[model samples]
Every structure is written in C-alpha cells, then in structure tokens.
Target: MARLAYVIKFVADMDRAVAFYSETFGFPVRMRTPFWSEVDAGETTLALHPASDANPAGSCQLGFNLDDLRAFYEKGAVTFSVPPREQHGTLLARMIDCEGAEVSLSG
Candidate 1:
C-alpha cells in the first residue's frame, strides 16, 4: 500500500505561512527554506511551496481536529471565515490562514 506523505499548500510568503501554521496549530517546522518548507502535522507532513500564477495561494482547504474549538478561536491567531458553531452535535469552525486558505476546525 502506498502511504501518504505531504499535503502541499501553496503560499505567497514562505516565512509567514510557516509561522502561521507553527504558531496557530503548534506544529513543529521540520524543514524551512525560501522555496519549500515542511511542518510535522502528526500523521502527515504539511508542505509549503511558493505560489505561482497557476497555483495561487489559498487554493487549498485544510481540516484539523482541536481539543478546544472555542479557545482556539479566541486566541485570534488567524482570521475566521466562520465562527464556531454546533453542527449535528459537534462544533465546527473555519479560519483563514495567512495565505487566505479556509481551514476547517472541529472539536
């Protein structure tokens, strides 16, 4: 079976994107460079790549499971596209990343 490795997210600013994920999600930066970087996202690595015209920033959506959705949202680390709300008995929220990607969060 083929194992999944990295989920690439195109970013306009590598440093900003890396910092956002590291600070907001508390993910550790495994690798860092101007053109490419990687964050250890538990089972998989989230790769950051420089965006081009064809692959613009904010072209991807990422989902994360949080222990405290409200607390995470309250931190104000990133801008929220949608605030936390109950969905079918679970809490869900959407936040905009540094690159404007809408990240889904659930607790």
Candidate 2:
C-alpha cells in the first residue's frame, strides 16, 4: 500500500498561506521558507508553494480528518464555506482559506 505524505497547495503569498494554516489548524511547522513551507498534520503533511503565473490560486480542495469539526471550525480564523453536515458516518464542513482555497474537515 502507498502512504500519503503531502498535499501541496499553490498560493499567492507564501507567508500568508503559511501563517493561515499554522494559526487555523495549529499544525506544527515541519519546514518553512519564503517560497515553500510544510505543516505536519499528524500522519500527513500539508505543503504550501508560491503561486505564479503558472500556478494559480485556489487550485484545489484539501481535506483533513479531525476529531472535533465543529469546535475546530468555530475556533479557527476561517470563513465557513460549506456548513457542517453528517456524511459517511462523520461530521464534515468546508471552509475558505486565506487564499480562497476550500479546506474540508471531517470528524
């Protein structure tokens, strides 16, 4: 079986993107620089890359398996994009990130 490691996201500002993820989820930073950064999300890593003419913003949606979706959602500095719902025997909600990307959290 293949193991999942990282999910890279292209954003407009690397600093802002890194700050957002760090603050929103409180994920520890594994590595960080001006052009690139990565967050340690337990079993997987969330990577952030600088957006350029080739890499547009809001490129894709990133999903996270969390324990308390509602609490994390409410406490975080994020705008709710999709309200919480029950599906697949879990609670899920989608929120907009600093760079307009959709991040789904499920518990």
Q: Cα-based RMSD of the predictions, in order?
A: 12.0, 11.4
27-107 in candidate 1: lDDT tens per residue?
999999998899999997898989988569966546677777898889898899899999869887878878766676778
Q: For candidate 2, list the clashing residue pairs, or say none.
A: none
Give lDDT for model 2. Answer: 0.76
> Which stretches in model 1 have alpha-carbon errors above 4 Å?
61-107
User: What would the per-residue lDDT of candidate 2 be over residues 9-87, giving only the tens digit for each residue?
Assistant: 8888888888899999999888899877899888878888877665588564466776667777777667987878997
| lDDT values for all models | 0.82, 0.76
Give me the displacement of residue 22 in model 2, in angstroms.
0.6
Poorly placed runs, candidate 2 (over 4 Å): 60-107
Indicate the residue-level lDDT of 25 in model 2. 93
Best by lDDT: 1
Q: Against the true structure, candidate 1 has what lDDT?
A: 0.82
